[model samples]
Target: MFSPHGPSLRELAVQALSSVERGYDLLAPKFDHTPFRTPRSVLTATTEALAELGPFSKGLDVCCGTGAGMSVLRPRCPELITGVDFSAGMLAQARAAHPDATWVRADVRALPFAGHFDLAVTFGALGHFLPAERPALFAGVYRALRPGGLFAFPLGAPPPPTSVPYWAAVGFDLAMRVRNAVWRPPFVMYYRTTPLAALRDDLAAAGFTTTAPALPALGRRRDGSPRCRLVLARKPADPR
Candidate 1:
């Protein structure tokens, strides 16, 4: 659901018809007004989890839309913080909001940095990439980090099969499939695609040791599992 100041049905329709870059450009001004922006609660939980493993130097935020991940990166990374995304419009909003942090306009699949970051965090942006594309995305993040550096993100538990949220996600992904079938310049976002096990396997294939620690701040699901877990992937340290 969107706020009173958020994009209307007509505006959203037009955005959905455009390419991802152009769509975000159109939505950038009111993105914060919509539910699409990462919630402050989730951000806080992620920050707390990362703080335990950090005291890091340079930090990178992959697919950093509107710079929400910067809140987590700033305190933990004292030396430098950078946010990278392909959307110029999103980068512009991020620049205006956090003028001091470095904003780079680059695609995550081909991140243009090498052993440059000590810590990296991404929030609420994974659904944009399909499962097959994740290899490139994870590989790039691995390549971007310094030896033994980390790449972390908060992942939510899948809703129970009988739950309303589960059905809602199913419906949303179904609608997206239909939309992409009929439309050009498809907007790729699917809620059900990234499962925790698959993602951990992908991280391993990309040469990172991966772990998921339950975020107590977010509480638990009805099934007694943590509502959210922070996936921490660490690139191996170079052999001396």
Candidate 2:
């Protein structure tokens, strides 16, 4: 699932044993060559979806590795765009790619902003947080957004139990759990933790109304469910 320029098996193995920040730091140079980077098509579809609700001023991307989300945020956010991540190496790459955009190094669970952004988006970074960690993550996003501002991200539907992809995901998560149990500097990434219902409930508790719109460009599953949906959570215009 990696390009010719992607990290070697030795590099990936070493990374898996390192702390999350260190691991990503090592992977940063070759990140775009791996499947781990958000796809351009996904970014384009997200940009189209967010366009319908915005002419936003400032945009923030949480866990913005290598500035993929910055591309999506740029056309929609006329004023300013910022990306935040914990890995200094990743931030370095992002700064180089989108020099004009602000790049901050911060843990997303404690995002350092208050009512600052008109729009926020995160891509493929949720698996890094455990279920217990999601509340704080959502709360930070809520605090970061301006009143009536939006927080949007696309989530893929779980593969069916009978499918090979489904089993692969299970195996990956299982392996991760086993690794974390016996390893130092635990790398926390799990595929099965963030269900739609749980995310909606967390967003609501964080004082945002949530909606999930099918991303048609991503296509549908065999059972006809959307393969992916963009979860749009909006902070209320009037504070309660």
Candidate 3:
């Protein structure tokens, strides 16, 4: 669902036919008006969670599209904030919107900084990365953080088999697979592929101790399970 300011069907069609980067570039101007932007509820919950764990210094927002995550980072880290993304168009919008924060155009997997930030956060970007690519991405985040620093993001509970949302995600993944099979410069975005166990293991292997905290603001499932959780990964104080 999109707001009145969101991209039109033709705009979305053009984006779907383009490469992921180019598609995002075309979509950047209207991205905040779409449901694709991380919800404010999740943002608030994450901001509060970070506040409880922090008073951090510098913060980095990986794949920070339109700078939504930077807003969450600013209060927790008073010193400085930086947003990095591969999309120049997104970075351009972010830079214009939040002139106070530094914006860098760089791939998350090959992030160009080491031990520079006290805190880092990413929102709604992991699904774009395949399971195997997670290690390199997590490692880059690890390298970007200072000793005793943290990297955090919120993840939702998997949709139940009987739910419409579950089938919707499955169908979307299937369609994407077919599209990638036929298209060049594949646009990789799959919601059902990444799991919590695999993600935690990858973060751990990348040398960060991890934890998942339930976000009460998102409410709970029928089984009394948290509907969403904030994943916090810490780069240890002693690197060795």
**1 against 2, candidate with superior lDDT:** 2
Q: TM-scores, in order shown?
A: 0.98, 0.98, 0.98
Q: Candidate 2: list runs displaced more than 4 Å.
A: none
Candidate 2's residue-wise lDDT over 1-240, tens digit each? 999999999999999999999999999999989999998889999999888898799999999999999889999998999999999999999999999999999999999999999999999999999988999999999999999999999999988899999999999999999999999999998999889999999889999999999999999877899989999999998857
Evaluated with lDDT, which candidate comes out highest? 2
Q: Residue by residue across 1-240, what tens digits does model 1's lDDT show?
A: 999999999999999889888999999989999999999999999988887897799999999989988899999998999999999999999999999899999989999999899998899889999999999999999999999899999999999999999999999999999999999989998999999999999999999999999999999977789999999999999813
Tell me how far the alpha carbon of residue 102 in candidate 2 is from the true structure, in angstroms, after superposition.
Answer: 0.3
Poorest stretch of ten by lDDT in candidate 1: 231-240
- Candidate 2 clashing pairs? none
Alpha carbon deviation, residue 137, candidate 2 (Å): 0.9
User: What is the C-alpha lDDT profile of model 3 across 122-205, one tens digit per residue?
Assistant: 999999898988998999999999999999999999999999999999999999999899988789899987789999999999
